[model samples]
Target: MELKKRIKLAYNVLANKSVITKDDQIRSMLDFLGIDQAETKGAVSEATYYACMKVLSESVGKLPLHLQQYTEKGGVRKAREHPLYNVCNSRPNKYMNATNLWGSCEYNRNHYGDGYILIDGAGINTKLWLLPSKNVEVWYDDRKILGDIPDIYYLYSYGGGILKLGSEEVIHVKGFDSLDGITGMSVKERLKNTVNSGIKSQNLINRMYDSGFTAKAVLQYTGDLSDENARKFTKGIEDYATGKLKNDGIKNIIPIPIGATLQPLNIKLTDNQFVELRQYSALQIASAFGIKPYQIGDYTKSSYSSAEAQQLSFYVETLLYIIKQYEEELTYKLLSEKEVAEGYHFKFNISVILRADFATQVKTLSTAVNSFLLTPNEARSKLDLGSVEGGDRLLGNGASIPVGLTGIQYMQNKNPKKGELHNAKK
Candidate 1:
């Protein structure tokens, strides 16, 4: 009955936006219908799940997100002068840094299945704020109330009331398994069974320890006592097992009542393969998050070489999609139409995260320079080395020729004996 009331309240909040609603009304509405923010947090209390979230959030948080502009030479450079550049690159608002903004956004994305950034103002006075995904509801403007064209809008329940925001006002980072593109399926919802099992497994272990490592058993009594007495007796046993009945250190003896036989179950956690079950659950959850087992400190079958390969694979497979989504969303929502048309957008410097060992990096850069794929100065810039004289030009081995002249050298040689003789005679 209570659940139904809350559901009705939520519908009311969504349907009627004629007047402003208070915080209490919004709170109750979310309490029943919205994402269980508490439950989402509790799920992260599991070690494996928390680790995966941390890995993803921190991976994005550490990289520099810059506003970039296309150069005449068809290359990109940071657009330092743009008004919104500093907001995304460093301080999003007075209270948060870029790291906090990105990390919190990712954490919310994983926890709530959607993360939102509200673009508070326009132009020079712009302020970016992270909105709690639970409090924000997405609605499509099917009625064309806001504009003639139907589009998605946001209803944010905050202190004052439900604030209706246009699509441009919010940046919605969606998760996987979204039936409708506007909303995403949260990790907690998608992997509820596995996560719940893990939590239960942890609780079971805690209970076992609290009972002084005792297994469950049957207390077979010959006769039944009165209801009150039975209740008291059960309470006494539980108190004794949990060490709540404090007598002066009478260690290691649980006295059995007369005519009652305690039949031990002889079941052990080891017998049930509890450890293996936990490991399997961790791996399964991690895999769902696109995390390699080795990343979460499970290097059971890892080699140094394989670890290196997995690191590259992690960037290509996992982080690439995550970064690209962020870049596209940020570019679309933050930049003006004119700026986007002028080829100005946002990009994350992912090279910082994918940096290889010094020796490998040097070798790779050297090969790029040798093949004329990168100018000597360009390769030097990657190493943070100062440019040397004449290093700006593309330099390669003498034997290598341009793609257009691939067979021209051979053709010249074949017709070349006559040409060579003419040159010699001259």
Candidate 2:
């Protein structure tokens, strides 16, 4: 079946409130969409499922604006000539324009320099503004100061020449030079810092391993067994610990004695019992029964014989009891096989327009606006706006204006930053 048909069928089933497993639902959806079953026969990988969901979610949107903007050239021109342009150009009276006052006295009033003199065309003819009376020292914003001296000072764009004033003092100004070729102690210090970080990471891993608990002990405690079998399993463990089973590894020995009669042992549990079971580890359960967790596995395997079978049955019931107790802690629904199959079949109608196809669709609307039959806002509304794929709102068939553009208002809100959609979903 085609994927679309299969999805339709799945949607019908879901609408009827039928119970089905998650896997079944996915399978049905794929079948409806006409997706080949052979292409995805095994367990669904996380990546494939996520990709399919993403495509389905994004398939309803219109073509991006950049591609369609060319169709509305007249509207674009009108927007640039709009009265809002004059409002943006007007500047505040107090803030002086730096470009206009560069060589003027007004620049000295705004800047933190003493009287400035513009040297006109000496050797380079470049405008050299000087702060001679006061030695203008520049410090970085983050630089620390000790008394009147800054720890570090940066000189920017000093004229490359020497100037002598009267007979008393001379100032030497040199062009900026980079320290790229200069190697010093700072490089060595950086290398040491990197090595120290690696050592710290290794120490953290070692500490985690030291404090970790073993999985074997936990599993044993959680396993269920009859009283007699439990005792026998406990004894076997003790024997192994004491070197009694040194010659024969515990793997060769059956922890629960053979020929032990067993009966169904039902443990009634309340809501609180369920909650507490989730808190207990498998090791804790094994400790309670005085047996190893692996012994429970051995007991389960030995159930083929009539006597051992009885003990195994009791252990099986105990396992179910623990499971029931833990079920309360589950956060998601456990869909049945059928429900899952049907969920896979859920139908969603997705409208897709190729770049070329979308252009054609909006061409008529653009023509109408260019001819002045429609205003820019009116023409924009006629072009599908709500159909944007991957946007927050789902599009339904209607003539409603696109979000952020309604009535006579044409304010352009900033586009969301990259990765914002993914973050919003999370």
Candidate 3:
């Protein structure tokens, strides 16, 4: 295609309502012009990126998602009797379990900037289907063709055709970067330079190995040689250097032609600090994902205490955002207005992941039970222990007194007819 025509077509494509997105049109135009864009999915090949994805996906997927209801006392309990409980807590669909579904959703959210879940069916037969973010496009119904009110719609491009779903039919978990709040900006779009640099550094190391780790050098000779002789000499040097022409199990010791001296260029990898640059790039990528270096196995500066603290920091700084978005989307999309108004919502059992050491857990639970913050059975239930007799009631230390009785102890020995001095003596 001609440049002008391609540009016109790109503009038209961007202007079209049926197009995937404006970004998609721009990317397609660049692709047509032989310009390659670094893809977010391609970053998964990088070790740190893969580790970050795994850390987040597993951390969230392994935790139990509960359909909780608020009690009269303002405490929450699992609403196991609700029809959505099984869908949220255990089996989401016939093919995938809750762990796989939630993990895939989280993975897609981080990789593609938005994760989608199709809320299929209604009432007791409802099933959740995880949709690929690549095929799903967020579209606005400015004309209100789908409904009486202007709202957002999801256009899922599948092999058969495009499936238009309403906003209520899909649960969309958006990433950290979103300007319009409808579509999210991917990590690849935001950190393209960093990702490309990391990929280039990896490729450079790989090419060095492939080239037999040879340094750039110039061949010096006293006399000019024929083109044929020069070509033969160059091929010989390359074959020998790359071990393609090995003798006596020796390689990389290229034999110089007669009257020729090879002068190597002194550009050491150390001088460039290639390793340090790559390490820095890794840190930057990890930071972009809100991942700690220790989580990805770069524990150079980590200690026992700091590592434990990083676990909490990881939850607060990284997983907290992901979990909150998931909870909000799931609750809003999966529950009806009545259910939401009645305090029925979806929540992740974060305690499953934020659990402390056994000793710490025991002490913490004991403290909660003794302080009357948790009933004895509640503390036992957290530890997966069955309740004992009289465990349902809250336990507390005997030192606490009612607020109204605060000054009663001081007046215990007071007599209405006695003076202050007589009462003090008594």
* Candidate 1: residue 299 lDDT (0-100): 86
How high is each candidate's TM-score? 0.80, 0.13, 0.84
lDDT of 1 by residue, 55-151 (tens): 9999889989989999989977789999888999899999999999999998889888899999988888888999988778888999998677798
Which runs in model 1 stand beyond 4 Å of their true positions? Answer: 1-41, 146-149, 220-227, 230-234, 257-260, 301-304, 375-377, 385-426
Candidate order, TM-score descending: 3, 1, 2
Could you give me the TM-score of model 1 versus the true structure? 0.80
In model 2, the worst 10-residue window by lDDT is 60-69
Pairs in steric clash, model 1 = none
Better of 2 and 3 by lDDT: 3
**What's the candidate order when arranged by decreasing lDDT?**
3, 1, 2
Report the C-alpha lDDT of model 2 over 292-332, residue by residue, as the tens digit.
33343334324344544443443344322322221211101
Candidate 1 Cα RMSD after full superposition onto the native fold (Å): 5.8
Task: Count clashing residue pairs per candidate.
Answer: 0, 44, 0
The lDDT values for all models are 0.82, 0.33, 0.83
- Alpha-carbon error at 37 in model 2, in Å? 19
What lDDT tens digits, residue by residue, belong to model 3 across residues 320-350? Answer: 8889888998888888899999999999988
